[model samples]
Target: MESSAETELGRRVASFRELGGLSLRALAAAAGVSSSFLSQLENGHTNASVASLRKIAAALGVTPAQLLDDTSVHTRGVLRAADRPSLPLEGAEKYVLSLPPLRNLEVYAGRFEPGGSTGSEAYVHGNSQELFLVTSGEVVFQLAEERYTMRADDSIEFLSSVPHRVLNTSDAPASVVWINSPPTPNESPHAPA
Candidate 1:
C-alpha cells in the first residue's frame, strides 16, 4: 500500500506499543489488525483509521486520547477523585489510590452494596499485610476460621495470606477503605514482559 502524508502518528504508535510490551503479532491480534498492516503503520508506510486507533488503545489498556494527545505531562503525587481509577470486585467497587507504582503499599476505598458479599470463595494474598476500615453500615468479616460482625467505624488489620472475605449484612450500602503493603499478586504488572 502507498504511504500516507507525513505524520508523527507512526512514532507514537511504535512508542506506545513498545511501552505496552507487545510484539507485532500480539498487538495486531489484540487490535484486530493484520500483522502486515500494523507493520505498515509502525514503519510510517500507512495511516490508521479512528476505529483502529481506538482498538489499539483498548488492547493496550489505555484511552485513545492518551495515544493521540501530545500533552502527556501531568502532575503526580496528589490525586483527585475524578482521576482516581476504580476496580470492580465481586460485590463491591474499589477506588484505587494514586500511589507511585513502585511503592510497596496499595490503598483502596471499597463500596459494598446491600447483601453484597466478596464472593463465596475465600482468597489469599501471599504474605502481604492488609488493613480494612468500615466507613459505614455493617459487615461480616471472616479471616481464616474466625468471623467478626463489624459496624461503622470498625476496622481490622491482619495478614492477607489468610483466607478471608467480607459480606455486607446490612440493608444499606457499606463502605471500607483498604490498605495493603507489597500489593497482591494479581495486582502486580504482567511479569515484566
Candidate 2:
C-alpha cells in the first residue's frame, strides 16, 4: 500500500502539472525524468526523492513548499518560522523563506554541518541571478574554477547558470541565505555539460 505522504505528493504533482496546462510527457521532459517514471510517480506507485521533487517544482514554476503544502494560507504575506518548510539533505539542510506565487524572486536559508557540502559536484540551474550571504560561521563557495571563503556577513552575487557548490569545513555549523531572481528552473545537478 502506498503511504499517505506518497499519495499526497503524487496528487500535488499531478495537480500542478494540470494547472500549468502541461502534458505528462511535456512535464517529464522538462523535469528530465522518463515519462514512465513520471507516470508511476503520479499514480503513487513509486516515491520520488527530494531532488526529483525539486526538479518537478522547478518545471512547474513553483517552490517545492508549494507542492508539499495542502493550502496557500501561509503564502499570504508572511510565513512563520515554525511553519517554514525544510529539506534536510545529507549533511546539509535548507529552509524556504519565500512564499508561493513567487514572481521573479525566491529566498532560502541553508544550514551546513561541519564537513558538510552541497555535493562533491557543482551544479547549474536556470537563468536567474543569485545572491548568497553568510549569516553565521563560515562557508567556502566554489563558483566554476574560482573558490572563495566567506565569513559571517559576507555575500556574493552571480549568475545561477554558473556551476557552484558550498562547503563548510569548520567544526561548527554554518548558516547562509540565498536570494535568486527569476526563480531557478529544472536543471539537475548531474545535467550533461
Candidate 3:
C-alpha cells in the first residue's frame, strides 16, 4: 500500500511536470526512469528510491528537498527547530525556518565550522535583499571588494545583486539567522551565500 507521503509526492511530481509542460515519456527520459515506472509513480501505485527521486528532481530543475517541501501549509504556522528542513551548502549546514516557495520571505539558520565557506565563487541574486544576524562566533562576509567581519549579535543588510560569499573565520563554530525577503526561486535553495 502507498503511504500518504508517497501519494502526496506523486501528486506534486505530476503537478510540477505538468506545469513544466513535460509529457510522461519526456520526463521519464529526462529523469532516466522507465516510462512505465514513472507512470506508476505518478499514479501513486509505486514509490521511488532516493536516488531515482533525486534524478527526477534534478530533471525538474529543483532539489530533492524542494520536491519534498510541503507547500500546502502556506497559511501561518510555526516550525520548531527539530522539525525544520535542512540542506547542505558549501561547507555549512542550512536549516530552513520558513515555509518556502512563497513570495514573502525566507528564514534560514546557517551553521559553519572554521574554514567553512558558503561557496568558492561569488554569485548574484538580482533585485533581492538579505539581512543576517550573527548568533555565535564570527563570520566573514565578502561583498565585491569589501569584506565585513560579523561577530556574535551583529546584524547586517545588503543588496543581493552585489556578488558575495560567507566564510567562517573563528576557531569555534559559527551560526547566523538569515532573512531574505522576496525570495528568489530561480536559484537552487540548497546553495549557500
Candidate 4:
C-alpha cells in the first residue's frame, strides 16, 4: 500500500492534470514518461521517484510541491497572515503570504513605504503568471507600455514573463498581496533587482 503522502501526491497530480485539461497520454508524452507509469502514479500503484516527479511537474507547468500538496483544509493551503515570510527588496519590504514548498502558485503580502518601488528594470521569466491585490493604500503598476493606478481593494493579473514594476504612491505605507504561479526555477524569492 502506498503511504498517505504518496496517496496525497497522486491525488494532487491527477487534479493538476485535469485542471490543465491534459489526457493521460498527453501528460505522459510531455513528461517523457510512459502512459502506464503516469497511470500507475495516479492510481497510487507505484512510488514515483524524484526525477519522475520533477519531469511531471515541469510538463504540468508547476512546481513538484504543488503537485504533492493536499489542499483539503479550510484555508485552501494559505499561510496565515502572521506566519508570512518576509523578503527584503531593494526599496520595499515584501511579505510572502503563500505557504512555501509551493508548486504552481505563489502568494505574497508586500508592504511598501511612500515613494518606494519594486525596481526600475524590466525582466522576463519562463511561463509564469502573477496577480497583485491592493489590500490597503495606493499603488501603481507599469506593464509594458501601459500604466495602471490601483487603489485599496483593487487587483490586477498579468503574465510575469514581461517587464513590470510596482510603485507605492501614497503617503501612508501601502500593503498588497502578490501571487505568482510556478516559482521561477532557481530564482531567489528575496532577490531584488
In terms of lDDT, the best-performing candidate is 2
Model 2 lDDT per residue over 48-96, tens place: 8899989988998778888888674223335678777777655888788
Model 2 clash pairs? 104-182
CA error at residue 28 for candidate 3, angstroms: 27
**Which parts of model 3 are misplaced by more than 4 Å?**
1-75
> Which stretches of candidate 1 lie above 4 Å from their native place?
1-75, 189-193
Over the stretch 117-146, how does candidate 4's per-residue lDDT look in tens digits? 886665565547787788999988788888
Tell me which residue pairs clash in candidate 4: 66-103, 104-182
Please rank every candidate by lDDT, starting with the best: 2, 3, 4, 1
User: Which pairs clash inside model 3?
Assistant: none
TM-score of each: 0.55, 0.57, 0.57, 0.56
* Clash pairs detected, candidate 1: none
Q: Least lDDT summed over 10 consecutive residues: which range in candidate 2?
A: 184-193
Q: Which is superior by lDDT, 1 or 2?
A: 2
lDDT score for candidate 4 against the true structure: 0.74
lDDT of each: 0.72, 0.80, 0.78, 0.74
lDDT of 3 by residue, 1-193 (tens): 8888888788878876765557899889999999999988988889989999999988875667767776832233357788777887667888877653344676789998888877787777755778878999999988889889999999889987788888997888999888777676576655443
Candidate 2 stretches with Cα past 4 Å from truth are 1-75, 186-193
